[model samples]
Target: MDDETSSHIDDTDRRTLVNAQGAVQVVRTTSESVDTRLQQLLDRANQQETEMTDVADAVSELSATIEEIAASAEQVENRSQTAAARAEEGDEAARQATERMDNIHGQMSDVRTELQSLLDRIDEIESALSGITRIAEQTNMLALNASIEAARADNSDGFAVVADEIEALAAESQEYADEIDAVLSDLRSAADSTDSELDAALVEVEQSSDEVERALDKLGAVADAIEETATDVTAVSEATDEQARVSQSVMDRCTTAAERATEMTTTVDAIDQFRAEQTAMLEEIDDALTEATPALSVTDIDRIPTGLDPLDEATDGGLLLGGQSVIQHDSPVVDVVATLCASALSAGYAVSVTPPEAMSRQDLSEGLASHGSSLSDALATDRLFVLDMFDEWTSERNIFDMRASSLADVNRETATRRDKPLLIVGNIAGEIALLGEEQARQARYENDSTVFNPADTVCNVVDERTVDESFGAFYAGAADQVLELTGDGPNRELTLRSSPTGSAPPRPLPATSTPVSPRGD
Candidate 1:
């Protein structure tokens, strides 16, 4: 009783002690709340840490990918630079080659001309020899007659000496005529061989010239592609750097939040301190999350590569910003067409195709698939647009279907020029002609007009056996140049019949076939 009374004291003292106990209860509740908040903050921090770890892993993976991309871009850039330099060199060399071929042709022509002149002189010499032979024959006959008369007149001794001298002279003249005839025959044979060899050499030089032009065109395209790829790689590197910086900033905030949580845990026993710390930590987390900035985006590239040296050359650096070309071949080069399209897309040029209506969709897809991944990606991204002519279209994915009912409408769009070249595949000229006389007339007008911009390059393919002679002549006259293909399979023969810009004769182009696979065999 005494101890309880002492502890309690008076009513006032008892009240004070009760108030103290209530205060203790309040402190305990506050402490519990503080602990709850701290645990909540800690849990949140832990979740954030897990997220940060995920982000770190993601960033690491992205960085590795970016590094590979950067490396590839660097390699591409370097190769492009080399290709550009090589193309320039090739262009110059081709120009020189053209000049040399011209010189050779002229020299051969001169040689032929000089040989003809020599033949003309030989004809004059032969005429002289013929007269000498006739004279010799007459002399021999006279000598024989004189010897017989001398024998008949019984004056054989003196006449025989004279006859013998005449006979000797005739024999000498006859031998000279025979030698002249033999010399003439040898000269004619040599001239014929020389003429044939000159013609062959001229043909070879012309062929070489065509090959050079094609190589230059291809190399130029490759250079353009490399430069564009390098640019993209550089942009990726910059983005990666920015991402790394942001990740570092996030980690710093995470560390700060973790330290705050630790302080809060330490002060869990002191609710007043805990409350202050929790408020500050929440603000820090909010600020850090809110303040994080996003990275910028990369821009699209331009001027792609055409894998084919000849095609690239004809198009003047892979169907680039400026320049136009037309091709008509005597073979089904669907693989070649697809390969070029793939090359262009890989190099960053937007492409659109108006496939032959005769071609089945499944076959077209299979043919395109023969090329590889770039074409698939191009279609997926809508970078490669296909204008379905007959409404029967098939593709790996759903694509934009441009249903132009009339050829004129298609022609109108075809004439509407863009920044990049459009590739018109299949029998383009033949198809246009088949669009009826009215449409053909319109196509003719479009072809002749200054406003014409169908494609930077137009390529038409037809089999050698089936290609119309008239069609070949039409394109030959209409196009800036003509490449006539013959044979089939891996070693098809391409002959450059004419180029308005060149003086060389028909040249045989190098045999090129689309690889079995797109990445190349």
Candidate 2:
């Protein structure tokens, strides 16, 4: 080969190696994110599956309870029907008793009338007996007079004998009259007693008839009430039956849902297995990629490593010297900025635009201290710069304020102050969180004013919670790369996207043994 051709081939090979190394880092980073998200989804699916199983059990119990209620309702209905029948029978018996009482009362009245008539006949017989007694006495008196006259006329024999016979006959007639009178008196007395008894019995029978009538009326009302109750009970039983049927249908649906949930769980398990396989494949590919281009290592390049190993790997070594990195987070990014500042301070000067409300100097210092760096020492050595994002920049004594100043001025001034590469960290999201969107917008505008000096590396941290998605997208679009942090605490994850249009899929930040706290607290 010609000398120039050989030289061109060497340059092309070197460039290809660099590109291939960058691609490996990107793939490795992307796979991590996929793995984290997949694990989260698997956990959620398992929880849902357990919850669905519990729901199925509850529905089964409800179905059983409904069946029991239906059975009880049926029993009540049968009992009510029986009660109605018994009431009806009682009512008929009461009616019959009332009729019998009425008949007995009528018979008693007839007997009473007959007894009274017999008493009246006995009285008449007594009167006739009295008359017969009086006649007998008169005849005896006449016979006595005839006997005395015969004695006075001394006419013995036949006349005197005739008078005596007449006297004896009169005496016998009087005796008979007395006996008939006594018998009549006795008959009258017996008849009076019988009439009194019959009258009493008739009264009792009448009262009994009235009592039975009342009872019959009451029984009839009870029978009607019982019948109504029976009907209501029957209706209740039917409604219970319907409810049981509906419950059965619901249970059936619940069973189907349970089956579906079980199927879903199985599907999720399958998906998890697939994800595991994909992850294994990714790891293998990453390993293969790592071996393919061992000659072109990221350490050979002059890039800044963010102390965070995961972040360094995601960025393919670290931030480019003049590139702008946007740190987007759901929470405060003070810790993120501090970590960046600490790393930047190692190589060159670090500058931060901070709002006191979001993070005071002490807070930032503490955050830096956690990473084994001293913010005060960096400031003493003139390697760190702090600016108040909300206050006006006044005199040298108040160089921290920068409300009237712009990022462009800071960028230019910082460059003149130090020949070393600068790391500029802006808190646009912090301003929005503490101040308002308007101020954040102003901050954004100020940041836009600064030119991309090759001697400086710029980073702007934004809290995703404080801004709209479109605004986040817009902010990300203006940056060279985006470092996005998600979740909180143990579940937190970080991803990096290095696409100019932000179209590239996000890759997981390089894994770290311990995560940096979002709030630096």
Candidate 3:
């Protein structure tokens, strides 16, 4: 379900604040139980890095694709324009052909008119021939009748010869008339056939012109379709570019988010482990305090050794089982005392952190972590408890306020002292809490009251960031052993301001084996 949701969000470009917060909370919750969540964050960061690379590659490919598309669209546009131009030219040609056809039809019409005129002339000729024939027929008939009368009169007159000549002339006129009629009939038939053929040619030319016009229209439509396709391709290219830009933004944001989550995971792991340790110590201490009595013997002293081998040897083997030491820490490095603290714990010392000058909760957790101790582990084992006077927001910090209502409450005496070593470091968050003279004086006074116990080691850290002369002077005066810490890097200078209760100050302390945090600017 979560994977699907994540995919959908990535697809939709939803980066709302609420969702980010929810995701962070989930990561934190996971880290609470195990380091798996941190690993997951790491994996996610790695995946995002890979994804960003892929996106870059994809963007490059998309750019190339877009260029290709643009080229194709341009080509298509050019082709469509060419096609449309040809269509226009074809329309012009078709129009010219139509005009030519019209002109031919008109010419044919004129030819028909000339043919009709010729026909009219033929008709006149035929009419004249008809009149001559009729006249000839009448003359022939008269000549015939005259010849018969002569023959009947039994006279050999020359009139019979005149009548026979008239009859022959009549026969020649009829022959001419018949020839003129035959010529007129043939002319009429030829004129009618030529006119019909001309009409058919005109119809065919007109049909061809119409077909050309239709073809031009279809060509125009095809050209328009190609133009429209080009436009759509161009639009798709632009949209792809926009999508690529959006993808780039998402990758950038994811990279940043992954980096931050990874850092948080690291810090959280440290705190959680340390918190667990402290919890365990706290539970043990609580049980001891409730059931155990305040008592100590010489045997208990051997169990209260500070973790540092040299420091322990210099201080006559180690701290007394119920002794208190004051450390004037010149640097902000938390590990300055880590060796001693862890060493003391190994010797069965239960430690409690109530620092007076931690800048924040991370400051406390980071400090303990540098000393080879997990704050969570200490808390879980009931050997440590943070009085919330520190950063009220440190995750390892118990949310409930640990700030004492009255200065005296801060000075509350150790409830019980058993055979086990009890080491309490007072005021882990006092740097910000005690800035002024009054606050410093009161905090110092409260701490002074709590310095002594039957069988425990009270450790006080005087961070120069907040501890003024009055604060340090009070803690040093109250403490049995005093140590001064100063350094920036690996070569830290440790000096014993005050040694054990007996014997001369031992040889100067050697260099620390464990690394101390680099001094801040």
Best by TM-score: 2
Instruction: Return the TM-score for each candidate structure.
Output: 0.37, 0.56, 0.40
User: Is candidate 1 or 3 superior in lDDT?
Assistant: 3
Ranking by TM-score: 2, 3, 1
Error of 3 at 176 (Å): 1.8
lDDT (10s digit) by residue, model 2, range 1-521: 11121111123333334334444444545555666766777677677667766776887788788789888888888888888888888888888888788888878877777777887777787778778888888889889888888888865668888989988998999888888877777787777788778877887888888888888888888888888888888888888788878877877777787677678778777876877787688667656654664342323334566777677766666765545567888844545566667666664545544533445565556656766677667665556677776452334422555556665566566555654556677666545654566555554445434443444556767666666554455456445567888765545566776532232334444333223434452
Backbone clash pairs for candidate 1 read 371-518
Task: Tell me, by lDDT, which candidate is best.
Answer: 2
Candidate 2 local accuracy as lDDT? 0.64
lDDT of 1 by residue, 1-521 (tens): 11121111113232233323323433444445566766676666556656655665666566666667656666766766676577667667766876786787788778878877887887898889889889999999999998888888875889888998999999988998898889887987887787788788778877876786777677667666766766766676677667656665665666566566556545543654656675566455434433442211112112234566654454334432222233455555555555666665554445566554444444445544544534456566655666564565753442334443454454444445334444444345335445643454355445434333422344444443444443333344333335555555555644555443342333334543343333220
Clash count of each predicted structure: 1, 3, 49
lDDT of 1 at 96: 81
Worst 10 residues of 3 by lDDT: 5-14
Positional deviation of residue 440's Cα in model 2 after best superposition, in angstroms? 12
